[model samples]
Target: MRRLHTLSAVSMALSGAISGLLLPVAAFAILGESVEGIDSSWVFVVAPLGLAIGVGYGIARYYRFSYELTAETFDVTSGVLSVQSREIPYGRVQNVDVRQKLVHRLFGVAVVSIETAGGGDTEATLNFVAEDEANRVQAEIRRLTAAIEADDGDDTRPAPSTEADTSAGDRTDSAEPRAARELLFELEFRELLLYAGTAIRPGAAIFPLFLLLVLTGDPTSLVPESITELSLVALSAIGIVAWALATSAISAAYTVAGYYDFRLERDGNDFVYERGLIERYSGSIPVEKVQSVTISDTLLQRLFGYASLSVETAGYGPGDSSGSQSTVPFAAESRVYRFAEGIAGVERPQFTSHPAMARRRYLARYAILATLVVAAAFLTAQVIGLERWYFAAVAFAAVPPAAHLKWTHMGYYVGDDHLVIRRGFWRRETTVIPYFRIQTVTTRRSLFQRRLGLASLVVDTASSRTFTGSVPTIENMGLEDARTAHENSRKQLQRTLRDRARDENVGLSPEMA
Candidate 1:
């Protein structure tokens, strides 16, 4: 066990002094102290005290923080006043991520985050470690985790002699090779631009634009004279388009910055991801922990023959750590499909389309929503004495085609090994979930669905997040199909569990002969 880098104390001291310096200034400003009368000398007095406190705290943290790695578990003990000791078993460790920010990069240090089967942020974080030491620690943990999983599995191979185990352990820590890592995918600048174009939501720009307007006051002068003379509806439309375009550009720049030098590679049964230009990140996920696979494409992506793929692991949130953990952020549809199939251990999800009647249901639903919107706009226009209600008619006219497109693209596939659900009109997503990973299966019906003799099948997985009472569902299936899917899913889950148990019990190990 070793203490953190010496720079930690300096960084901590600087941070504390900066934090403490604000207090006296704030107090003086709040007290209405005159610039001439204000005591600038207090900051000097406070700075050293703050620095002393910070440096003492940092040194205490460094001294208290220590870790020991064993064959089965990595033990960490840390605290300032009250001591906390935690032992994380290698089998339960989900990911070991190494992150280097600009400061850390300058100092040649990295922060190591350890995530486990229990979620809600990482279980442990070791800050400000030497870059080389961080890499070695990450690799060592991964090797230990892999070795533990292999050892726990009922493999019948003879145990390595003590001599061999020690020698093998020594080699495993240093065995990671750049050449051994198979390059699976890389995101280029053009692909990142395409990703931004397809993934950014135009509606999301409204809040930021409104914030800008509030902060900067009115921008009426920026509006063109001809556009300013247009009807309220037209102006609103123009503003939305302009804002969306601006937002898309910002999103493009963010995508490039966040994903520069993005690369994905394979290391044994794990996948390694590395990216970022300014703040580098390296993370790994075990293949066996994958809960579900999703391949998605927006309308623009469809036109460009590109798609994005993401994998969900148990106890891991989609937004946790490296946001989305995209397997392929942007790739040609053909390549994405190939990778998805390989990862999912299945052929393409050629699911059957929803029944033709689903189109009628979609049309009715969208038509009602569209009617309400148009009616609202008409009423507003009437109240405002504007003859711009023609926009309402235009909106209503688009509903039927949009509904038809939704129904045309929506489909589901129930297989012995996996259940696949496909949906979305503007953005198409196909989700493939293994039966063994499913925690529950349910059916739901809305009022309209009940009236239409339709229901939805919801698949619940341990890995999926439940937010705002919403879960992933195969919506608007015929009632009978929904029930059938529910029943089949439950049966598949039970069967898979039983089969796994049987394999573990009977087939895993040969009799000692």
Candidate 2:
């Protein structure tokens, strides 16, 4: 069954590519010869001639395919003329996944994949094995892993309760589809729309809309003439706003059709989500796979106590990672924080504050940058014989003071187990990282910072696996102190993570699995 699906897919891709080339060429060839038009001969005659070759390749690939899988290895053999086979070892297997497309669902079949560790490549799936075979292969690998684990005395820590084990089979972990768990959190059509509208992609409103405004429409009269050569800037701003509006409308229209009816559910600790406009996609995400949890706020969401949540799971694949952090996108802000609290299992979040910067400090930084601009304008005025009159007026136009507004927004929060980064004013953004997740930590001190005896700490999360928990720059801390703190914090965090895994094995695994 799986082989058939693979063959079908290869056939379809090849056929589609060939069809794309041929339709145009075939049309042009007949028309070009008929019209005797100036360029028509080349367009009509030559196009189809080239298209025929592509069509031939597609047909050949569709007809030739074969694959096989066993406990220790899986083999794939396929090609039109030349034959090829590749073998994969059980030790290298990192994950085994099952995917069911609409077409597969019709015949009760699914695509199975064998993912290996330590590579920027894939070597699994002798290309679409039967569902039972896929499950058998997954089981064999699990059985081997479990034996190794049991030899290591891991069986004392019972496996976590998974939605995949509804049926009691001989091999608990192997030879069966882990029950697909509903999402720990999920989103609805309406909420997904709002998220896609405001949060999914950054600068959705201002940047894209601005570009569209320039490309699609034009309006230069919107700027006031007396605003000191701000016409181009004004026109650009107007265009951006218009573009945002148009995209928003387009996004909303998609909301009604694509995800108008959707489902977000989880099984055990893994999440199962489904949504689509044309091609439907659904998958499972394990709890251990979750890398990060993000909560986003728009101006409106802030006031409404609503926010969007996004998570990057360990195995957070294409469709799994796209939704916002929270299963519920519109949850009140406090709810998200509480959920974060629950996920990290921290009751108290520590805080490290900075020396409050007064208006003086802000003006100091702002003025330094502002000085160059002021000098440039002053020199220009003198060169043009406007001297102190026009120059002073332009230089003292309160630009530095206006820029100073941004300075006050810089701050940081360092907790025992997490770091909170703060920057930007009107848009308040915050990020959190667990201590144990830090793969690397570094400290920096600028020339000015050296005078203040201060430094910033940059902690990078471990990216070895796909799960990226957190990364942040913590301020008002020295290199020695930061390193010491991180080391101690990590030791404590490791103990906690291990304890949690144990507790999960004892309490949650059986109940859920």
Candidate 3:
């Protein structure tokens, strides 16, 4: 059994003390009272008590937690009050991630997270381990998993011992030689800047603005009386512009910081990536376990002829955005496609567009939306005795172009062994899913789509769900085309799985006979 590095207790103590200090601050904020009035004398008492409790708890936790690697499983025993034990088999291990924040790096420690397929979250976390120990653990787990898989069900064969000798004291030696890594892609500083600049995040700006309001005590109070007297519509327009600018600046800064010095390399059958400046992350994605490959570009990125490529695996759930590793955060569209081809063994697809009725449907939807907005503005103007509200009717002019762009960008293609689905105008995405990896094929029709003789075809894989809630969908296809695609996908999936099973059986040893 191996315990965490000695410094882990110190780290935990610091974290616990910080959490304790924030309790009063949080309470004051929740009660809508200022924290500035707290007596200085109470700080001495509260701080010492919090520090003592934190130190005591940290020491206890350190003694209680221990982990060991055995022949078949990586076993962990943890918890101070309620002892819980977990045994994670090497065969089920999907990824071993090493993460280091600035403080952890300073302390010469890292966090190792072990993830398994369908786990949704990290299956096991070895927190605050020595950096060398973390690397050894990651390599050992990979070697053990590979060995197990290669054994081919020979149960009587003895498994190699992977347990490390804790008495050796911080040794980093591994039993097997590490695989040579080939550099596949690296983001240049200029490219990183471009990627950061293209990030559009209007929603992320709200939190900062809200925080400012909470801390400053009122938006109107910060401005002049003359500015506060502005019309509601004018004030809203100003606020929207301010929000957009704030969002762009903050999001760009965040992107640059998060993806600094990004690099992706191939180590045998796994793709390894390292990224980040303040909080570094190094993780691996097995090529064989990949469920889908996605190529996406935002409106600005498309305009700049840049796109990003990401790969998804079953080890992480849809809600875990970090699970989908972006192999190319920002690159020339052609470059992105080339990288995707090298990784997934698939080429750029020639997509077939949806029927013309789909365009009309989009136009109708936007036109109705514009009309409703104009009517709402007019009613509000009547109530408020305002004159310029009729300007909202200008939204009607955008309907045609918006509809055309949406229609033009939506298409799908069915290859011999893969399905390519493309959609979106503001942020276009193209997903490539292998037939063998597909879990389900579904077709849906809304009342409006049915009236237009159209249907939607969805191809779902184990990792199909994404941060944007976008799935592999061919929307507004002709009813017959949709039905044909659904049936063809199912047939192809079955055939692919059968062929794979047959191949596996043929590769089995003669001892089975």
Question: What C-alpha lDDT, on a 0 to 100 scale, does residue 118 get in candidate 3?
Answer: 57
Model 2 residue runs over 4 Å out of place are 4-52, 60-200, 203-240, 250-262, 277-279, 314-328, 347-350, 356-430, 445-452, 464-471, 475-481, 493-513
- What's model 1's TM-score? 0.81
Residues 66-141 of candidate 3 have per-residue lDDT tens digits of: 8887778999999887889999998888778889989988877888988888557788898878887887778767
Best by lDDT: 3
**lDDT (10s digit) by residue, model 1, range 1-513:** 555666665666567566565665566565546566657557667656665676577667767887766666778899898999999988888888889988778877888888887865788887767777677667778877777666756543322112222211122233256786777787887787777767765455666688768876977655555443265556778778887778887776667766788898877778888888788988887877777888888888899898888887777756687563677888998888778777776677678788777889878878899888888987876765556665676776887898889998999999987899888878788888889888888898988789888888989887765211235689899999999899999888889788866653211011110
RMSD of each: 6.4, 8.7, 6.2
lDDT of each: 0.74, 0.50, 0.78
Kindly indicate the candidate among 1 and 2 with the higher TM-score: 1
Clash count of each predicted structure = 0, 35, 0
Instruction: Give the better candidate number (2 or 3) by lDDT.
Output: 3
User: Per-residue lDDT of 218-336 in model 2, one digit per residue for the tens?
Assistant: 53344454545344446657766777676676655544444543554544444444455543434333444444444456666666666644444332322322332233344567766
Candidate 3 worst ten-residue window by lDDT: 504-513
- The top-ranked prediction according to TM-score is 3
